[model samples]
Target: MASNRPAESTSFAPSGTQTIGFASRTDEGPWEEWNPTEDSVRPVRGRHRVTKQRGGGLARSSTVLGVGVMAAVGAGGMATAQTGKPPVSISLPDLSSVTDSAKALIGEEQASAPKGSATVLSTAGVSTTEAAAGTKNAGEALRARIMQQAESQQDRIAAEAAKAAEAAAAKKAAAAAAKAQDAARTKAAAEKKAAEAEARKKAEAARLAELAKQFALPTSSYTLTSRFGDAGAMWSSGYHTGLDFAAPTGTLIKAVHSGTITQAGWAGSYGYRTVLTLDDGTELWFCHQSSISVTVGQKVSTGDVIGRVGATGNVTGPHLHLEVHPNGGATGIDPMAWLQSKGLNP
Candidate 1:
């Protein structure tokens, strides 16, 4: 380290005794101090020349040498601090040595640099601009990829929704078809039942018409004055056992069916009477008649005139009482019902 102490100074004698000499040694010969004069000094041979100034100051070459030494010392100190290494010893250089060393260092730096390194450093701004452009391109590519993926997802969802809707519609259509089929089946069954009923009714009507051809009404132009089983004081059996037909006294009575006249004539309260016996053993009796036109044991056909209506046998007016007996039983049955069985409405 350099000290902070001041440098030693030498004082020269005053004006008139200025001549002084110093003993010095030189490469050429033994040194001798001599007063310097322009005539006594020799001209330097190199490009640089040393000359004494009017103010007795150092030469410009010496000043340049001092500045070079300071610069080198400063640079060495800075390098030591940055590298964290022990400081290296530096020797002060003579004027000629400093110049030669600076030239050599500059040459070495030029040789160590890589090829085209200077050109690359000079265009550094261009590289920064290109890097920014590359980043922008990459961002655009990423955004495009994201958009494509979103679109694909949307399409998938839409397809699924449409498929579901179509399935629901198909199911609804199937249900409607099933309901319509059931209705059609029910209607067909109802129509079949109605047709069967109509057919049965027609068959019954045909049967009744055929029976009407074989049977006949016993009388005409007469009103039913009394029905069998009627309760009245005029009847001997307490309840009437025969049907009565009322009309003018001359109303003719007919045989209900083809039968034999088994008995004819008056019998007590029955003023005039006639009995008809059918081949099936069913008997028909006519009473309260004005007169009898049939005789016993005589065969008569249906619709034959057998008697006339008259007020007799404890009757209130002119009317014929008719009775029916199935298989000739003593107790007679309702004549009106028997007439209906033979297809007679009267």
Candidate 2:
């Protein structure tokens, strides 16, 4: 360590009255005083010029020299073990140039750097940046995977719901169809029964109407001598062919029921015959009449006087031969039972 001690001062008189003092690191005690008379400041040969005590160049140069010596000592220590030669060292008097260049590099980095996430990555180290990028990528991938799985699950659930809805709809449709079919069947059966009942009623009405048109005995005084199925030698078929009404020939032959006279004339076997046809296609034959007051196609009312009783055809004398034909067929029915069907006992 160098001692910070003040040395002896020297005085110099440059003009008649101007005075200057100087001090140094080394001093001998015999101080000198002199007058310096010079026109300009100058340097001595082989030495640097000394100026006033301003502490400008000398201080700066000394600082540079001390840094250089320290760099040299450190380099020599670093090189001594392997090689006898010392490593080279260079020192700058002012480090502002290198620091300015470093600042320029930082500015360029700032100017050309990316913004947002990329800007953060440039300042960070390699391991830190890589780890951050990997973490971000992993997070994004995991989110994407979760979204895809969610979409798949949603699609599966939607498909299942659709299938269930379709099944329910089909089941409802089937049940409705079955119910409709049952209703239709029941309706059809009821209609069939009603139609059958109506048809039977119509048939019965028509049968009664036909029976009313037949020539039955007006009074119960007549008797049945010739039945429809009695075997007889007088008939052409060797059987009794007509229903007989054995009344006196002159007895009033009232109209059997409401009808039109289809024929009223002298027929060969059934002389003075009268055929009356009812509306429902039944025919009444009155034969062996002494007189016929009705003509063909003549309309008549029930109980009206149509003819007089007579034995005009192949029959017993002074009797009426009467027969009933359904739709004008050859065969005849029993007069007694046929008249009874119309609520009349004969």
Candidate 3:
């Protein structure tokens, strides 16, 4: 858009012929002479040259502080990084007392920035030495706790095993004791039985000896002329029925066994005879006796004189006829065999 208000004009005064003019159509035809030339349009050199401005002290100091903040984070200081507090709000560490990388970073920051001024970034990042010490302490405490637990568990297991072993040993000892006790009881019982058997055997032997002392023979100092069971036709039954003891007349004849005299008088064909009946109903016949000393029904002991030997019956010489009737049987056992059976080989 064109402005319609007053055009701005400059008031000027000319020195000699200075004037302002407008070009007509004739003058506008070829104005090559008015074109600019190189030398005439060239820029001119001036005396003044641009210089750099001085920067503010605050800006440089701020830059140095920023560097210090980053250095605190990398310097391994406890007041920075892992402290969790704002870096500027954290306590400023004593540079002289700081150790390892923290001391080095503090020195650099002192040279670059201001004295006694430092930033805390992260303690985990910057406080290398203290952080490692804390980690090691924690690991050691944990290891000690684990070792204690393991030892306690081992002790408990060992105690249990020892208790079980003791129990087993006690059980074994009890069994052994019981076995020994049973063995002793059994041995005692066997010994008692043997002792009783020996006592009974000795008692039986004493009784048999006493019985042997009580038995006796009918007569002594007599010659055996005939034995029982000898074939003969002179007596009844056609056999020698009694043992014949050849002796002189009036030789003593005693009771062969303990008995009572049942007959003490003359018997037909036997002359003066005596019959001794024993306790078991066995009769002992003493025939051809000259006389009888024991009366009838008189009790006699073994080796008691009851009669005298004489040849009064159907005999060829003076002798004693002794016959045995077992249980009152007509036949009797051989006297020699009977005597041998009683442990007397007659």
- Number of the top-ranking candidate, with TM-score as the measure: 1
Clashing residue pairs, backbone N/CA/C < 3 A, model 1:
22-33
Question: Candidate 3, which segments miss by more than 4 Å at Cα?
Answer: 1-208
Backbone clashes under 3 angstroms, per model: 1, 2, 12
lDDT, candidate 1, at 33: 54
Give the lowest summed-lDDT range of ten residues in model 2.
Answer: 119-128
Question: What does the lDDT come to for candidate 1?
Answer: 0.73
lDDT of each: 0.73, 0.68, 0.72
User: Model 3, 140-186: lDDT tens per residue?
Assistant: 99999999999999999999999999999999999999999999999
Candidate 1 at 73: error in angstroms?
A: 45
The model with the greatest lDDT is 1
Per-prediction TM-score = 0.48, 0.38, 0.40
Give the alpha carbon lDDT tens digit for every residue of 1-346 in model 1.
9879898775443332332376433334233456999876876544343343444323332443344445535544321235668867766544463465445443443465565543111112323234345556777988999999999999999999999999999999999999999999999999999999998878866776777776787778889978989998878899999998888998988887887999998877877888899999988888888989978999988788988888767778998888898999999998888888667788
Off by over 4 Å in 1: 1-193, 228-241, 263-271, 327-334
Q: Judge candidate 2 against the unseen true structure and give its global Cα lDDT, from 0 to 1.
A: 0.68
